[model samples]
Target: RVDFTKIVEEQKSLREDFNKLREDFNKMLLEISELKKGYGRLERRIESTFNAMISGLTDLSKYAGLTLEDFTRKILENYLKGMGVLPSDRSLRSETIDSEQIDIFCEDPAIVGEVTAYAESTKEAEKLLKKASVVRQKLGKEPKKYLLVMTTNKQVYKDIQKISEENEIELIVGRVV
Candidate 1:
């Protein structure tokens, strides 16, 4: 009463089903791999586009004959003037003394500042502090105000802001460039 043929046929069917499942799993793995590759490509493309845009904007700024530092200096001067911290007639300008360059300096009101397109680290804040110290040492007096002016708010990190606050450095962001 044993049906060997039927048992063999059942075994063959099970093997076929197992093979089909394995093929399906392999296909799914390939699809997942392809999706990952596609995502990587898209991420790279977006980064490239962003860099290109920034480069274009920099070129345009150059053509306009105004560097980011110059633009930031004008904005800071206007702001200080409005606040009555700086005189209406006194304008900010760069000066180099004792081989140290001050990006924005005013003698009478004793304002010392540095300008940058973006501030992304505490190092920038520390650099301004060091410059301020040098100016104080050279001039034999502390400046009335220390400033760090940024043209773009795009990359002003929290650590930079905190350091500026703790060190009593006024961090001002004019506008996005």
Candidate 2:
């Protein structure tokens, strides 16, 4: 016979796990709050111009279950498909963590998705641009699918525009994080 108390204990364990998850989530929220303290400068500048460019929730609590990379890849894949740039069959590559790292690589077209994910700092943005350049160089003189750099930071968009025009790289940026 099944021990009914054992089932009750199992339920208690599940509740404890959920409670731990909530604590972790709240901790992440505090971290994000601290990071965003001085990031709103450009946000204020572009408030008028890209008012419509930014859509969706300013607070991302609904996505608490998702990691930054997961969130970025999903948003990117959907955004590319939405922009009619990438094929619907394309999926993000995640397993390989190589020196020449790429977030998502399209198999058929061989496009590389190098997302910056810089909500505050532009260091990640710069690194992605450099990596994308190196990847392009490694495949020199061959036609390649676009290497997209996606970021939520407003400041990076300016840099992206300048770089795209200079190097002829394609970039897709979502306005609101």
Using lDDT as the measure, which candidate wins? Answer: 1
Tens digit of lDDT per residue, candidate 1, span 1-177? 269988999999999999999999999999999999999999768645644554455446677799866755665677679889999989989998678788989877777887666655566677788888877887787875454433435455556657777878876543334
Candidate 2 ranges beyond 4 A from true positions: 1-64, 95-98, 119-122, 137-157, 173-177
What's the lDDT for all of these models?
0.71, 0.55
lDDT per residue for candidate 2 within 108-172, as digits (tens), equals 44456555434355454465556555555655532232333334555656666565566555555
> Which of the numbered candidates is closest to the native, going by highest TM-score?
1
- Tell me the deviation in Å of residue 109 in model 1: 0.7
Clashing pairs in 2: none
